[model samples]
Target chain A: MARLVVLGGGVAGHTAATFAAKWLGKEHEVVVVTPNSKWNWIPSNIWVGVGQMKKEEVVFELAPVYKKAGVIYKQAKAVSLNPEGKDTSDKPFVTIEYTQEGKVGESEDVEYDYLINATGPKLNFDATPGLGDGSGQMGTNTVSVCTAEHAVHASHELEKCIQKMKDGERQKILVGTGHGTCTCQGAAFEYIFNVEHELKKAGVRDMADIKWISNESFLGDFGMGGLHMKVGGYVVSSKIFAESLYAERNVEWLIGAHTSKVEEGKIEYELLDGTTGEETFDFAMLLPPFSGVGLKAYAKDGSDITESIFAPNGFMKVDANYDAGAYENWKASDWPKTYQSPAYKNIFAAGIAFAPPHLMSKPMQSPNGTPINPTPPRTGMPSGIIGKAVAHTVCDLITQGEGAHLHEASMAEMGAACVASAGKGLFTGTAAAMTVYPVVPDYDKYPGTGRDTKYTFGEVGLAGHWIKHVLHHMFLYKAKLKPGWALIPE
Target chain B: MSIEEENFQKNDNFKLTMLPGAFAKRMRTCVVWQFIRFMVLNIKMLIVVSKSH
Candidate 1:
């Protein structure tokens, strides 16, 4: 049987494995290797951080779901790839170390006819001093909402801070990216406002001070360099929209900032204007930057060919123009359409596993030579869409033979809808719902803003919170492989 | 004022803040208005999702 192995089971890997299994049926083998046993619907983790939802609400067991889909699921972390096998064999295999209950640390090599690398980000917390425990995990000084467990911890910390506020002791709260290269500023943005709302609900609004710090050169640059949204019959930049929200809610901000260090109750940061400062807080929730999970590759002679197959950052090399140097020379066409590795046709990468050609934001560096800019965000809607497209191509290759046409889902051609929650109450809650077309702006196609403002829009209200809540349940249901799940759009 | 507050004040963001009017703020949570908005917003999102495929 033609075996297909998908590494990592986040949004991308899960979608690819499940769809490929259904399409290939009993004719082919589909194996999914993921370190975790549970599937987490990440967006809802923000709600979990505010105690609006529990950890169990955002995550579900992956074993049962895979079983129901007639797919083999291996609870293991992928270590390396031997794409050229050994000197005696031409077949390819991936080495995986089991993290499963009974087989913890047990290593095995599984041969594959095709491979998909969707290992996602390593959550490189150690990129900044004191941001990590030095063992590749979050540090003790601050909390995180990146995972369901992290959100649970963050919720408890927030509760303690609120209790201190209730006792008439003032507290300062800070939330944003921990490192300059961090993505997912949206999560931190949602969290700070939620904390503010909860403090007010607890009758301690005056006792708490909240502030935002991000790597974005300006506010609302949720990495695709910010888009112009048509709001109230006028096209307004996200910078204005975001500033309005922050100002209205009495939340202050620090932009063009790279959080350089984290210590007990204080953080040192460097700004774009070559200035450095320190901010102190009683509570902090800062996200870490992402890197590849460090999967190595070897050739037939067992010589390391990792550099040929993956980027320097550890993400797999895909069908994109990597040499597109200089910001002024960048083009939308530089984005990968098929997501297939150029050197090996049988290998592919989806989601954050594939390295992008360059930064979507205008690259900037401090006078001290420290790079402080937000990296591209390859999560949520775009990740799912790319996953499904790659799955389609894999299935076609198996069924329609070697001449099968590849499917494409380039970020440059994709439209994304983001509903960023501000707070969570049925009537009192608020959120900003935004839509952007052609996420990677094409200057030649749409001149000024590089986006079609007609298809791009945003608004904020109680209605948005309801939609965000609805999506939480809808996405979970789809991930659970419920009946008619395919009918739900990615 | 604190140095941080002054740092924020020096920026031109204050001039661009679009604080909704009293009527607009009331409409944001008005059951009827929000219900209509809920439907319209979903339709808009569906359009975006459709074009993406």
Candidate 2:
């Protein structure tokens, strides 16, 4: 029986492995190798960071779930890939180091007939000085909500800041990107507003000076170049929507910023205008930029073939048009449909692990030649869609034979619904629910805004907040592989 | 026209508002309307996911 091994158990990897296991049944083996024992519903991390939800509420043990699904689960991190096998054997395998209890640092080589590299971003806190120590972890100075543990810590720190505010101390809050190239501006945006909402509820809003600093050229860019949103009655740009939110909530902003360094209570940053400055904060939540979780590849003869498989950013090279150059020249066809590796027919990549053809935003550089633009956002929706699509292709290849055509799920052709929470109240809180048809805007399909106006829509209000709450439960239930889980579309 | 409702102008790009089954796409700020809109939008989102690929 052919073995299908998947690296990483994040949203994309877990979905692919689970769906593949169900589709292939007992005929083929499906193995999942990931570092974390718990599967994190990352979108709920915003609520956890603000102390509205417990860490356990956003995460669950993955071992039991995978066991129930009849899939082999390895709590380990992949170190390297040997697609052509080792010198001792011709069977292609991957070297994985165990991170589970009592087996830390222990390793094993497991061979596979087909492999899916869904090892999502490395967090790369080291990309910005003081965001982390030179080592690959978050530093002590600032807080992050990228993980369930980090969210709990951030919530504790925010509580301390709130207590200080209650003592009549004016706490300065800074929330935004840690580096220029960071994605997930929506998460950061959600966090800053959540903090604001919490402080207001605590009756210390007047004393707290909350500020947002991001790499987006304009507010509301949220990495997808700021679509035209239908707010109120008029069709204003997302920049306008975000600005109104900030203004109405009494929060301030500093856009076009790239955080350069972080200290105990201060941060140094460079703006797109080529000016450098420093800001002090009592509480800060800075998101680290993401890169591929570096995995090396070797030939059977012990030759390093890492460069042939991965992009410069360490992301696995897929069927995308990596050579697609310049912002003005990018086409909808630049995006990959099948996500299959060009060199290895048995290799595929999904989620953030795959290198995108280009940034969705109009790429820009600082006056001093430093690139300062938000990366394209592949949020939970697109990631899950890509995962399901990849699983479909792989299943077809195995069951329907090798000549079967692969299923396609291109970002340029698929729609995504992103509901960004602003506060966590059942009826009082607010959120912005946006639906963009074809996550990657097709300039050729629709002129001017490059999006189909009828299909692209958003609104911010209490109703949006309620939708966000429902989604939190719906997605978690779906991810746990509950009954009728497949009914929940990607 | 009242100053509060006067802020809402005609010719909004989206004829559909956040509330499902609500014909009015104009600005709504009343607590009563907000409650109605909440239920409507929640139902709409369910349909959105069900109908979406």
Candidate 3:
């Protein structure tokens, strides 16, 4: 029987493993190697950071779910990949170090006929000084909600700040981009609003000042560039909607900013116009830049193919046009339809593990020649979709023989729906529920904004807030592998 | 007040003035007549502009 091994158990890895197991059935073997023992619904980590939810509510143990699926689960991290196996064989084997129970740091080699590398991004907090402790933990100077543990820590810090405000002390709250080249501005956007909501709920909003800082050239450009949304009968861009929301909430903003350094209670920043300034805050939540998790690959002869297997930024290289230079020259066709690696035919990558062709926005550089642009973001929906597609291709190859037809699902041809919460309440609340068709811009099919106006729309009201709350529970239910789990999308 | 005196008061900055009950009734009728006259004039002007165009 052919063996298939999936690495990392994030959204991409979990989807690949479960789907591959079901499709291949008991005939083929499926093994999942990941470092974490629990699966987390990362989107709802925003509420946890604001003390609205607990860590346990956002994460659940993976053992029971894997047991139900009849799949082998290894609580271990992959160290290296031998794609050409040894000098003796053509089969590939992966080296992993267990991190479970009393077998922590134990190594093993798992042979596979096909491999899917859905290992998500590494949180590179060291890219900025005073941002992280250099050991994958947030530094004392600032707080982040990227993981469940980080959210819990941030919630405690936020509680302290709220108590200080209630004692009649004025507090300054700064939230946004930590570095110039950071992505995931949407998460920070949700967090800043959540913090505002919590402070108002604590009855000390007037005593605290809220401000936003980001590297986006314009507000509402959430990495995939600015999109048009229909509100009422009028068509308007997200820039206008986001600006109005910020104004209505009385939250001040600074765009096109590069946060250079973080000191105690203060952060030094440089604007796109070459002006430098400092902002002091009683509390802050800044997202660190993302990079590959640093997995190495070698040939059978021990020649290093790390460069060939990965992009310069550390994400795996897929079937994309790396030479698609400049923003004006980029096309929808440049995106990868099939996620097979160029070097190894059996190797595939999905989610944040795969390298995108280029940045969604026009590339900008600071006066000191440091490149600053929002990195392309592959959110939960797209990550799961790509994982299922990759699983289908792998299953076909194993069952239908080597030259079978592969599956195709390009990000440029898919649509995405995002609901961002401004506040959580039934009567006095607001949120922006936005749906954009063709997540990647297709200039030839639709001009100007490169999105279809008919299916693209956004509305900010209490109903939108309810939808966000419902999605949090719905996604967690799906991840738990509960009854009727097959009805849920990957 | 006489018609000449009433016209002087209406044209002044003081927007309101007291009058006898019978005189107030007559003033309301005159105001309605003046409004109808103004609307007819505007309609004639609009028709002239449209014809020219």
lDDT tens string, model 2, B1-53? Answer: 53223222321311122222223323233456767867766555455444334
Extract clashing residue pairs from model 2.
none
Candidate 2: regions farther than 4 A off: B1-52
After superposition, candidate 1 runs with Cα above 4 Å error? B1-16
Q: Residue by residue across A444-474, what tens digits does model 2's lDDT show?
A: 9866776765666777666677778878898
Instruction: Please rank every candidate by TM-score, starting with the best.
Output: 1, 2, 3
- Two-chain complex of model 1, DockQ on C-alpha atoms against the true structure: 0.43
Chain A only TM-scores, each candidate in turn:
0.99, 0.98, 0.98
Model 2 scores a TM of 0.93
- Tell me the deviation in Å of residue A103 in model 2: 1.0
Please report, as a value between 0 and 1, the fraction of native contacts recovered by candidate 3. 0.00
Q: Total clashing residue pairs per candidate?
A: 0, 0, 0
Over A101-126, each residue of candidate 1 has an lDDT whose tens digit, in order, gives 99999999999988999999999989
* Full-model lDDT for every candidate: 0.90, 0.85, 0.81
Which candidate has the top score in lDDT? Answer: 1
iRMSD, all candidates: 4.1, 7.9, 24.7
Pick the winner on TM-score between candidates 1 and 3: 1
lDDT of 3: 0.81
What DockQ does predicted model 2 obtain?
Answer: 0.14
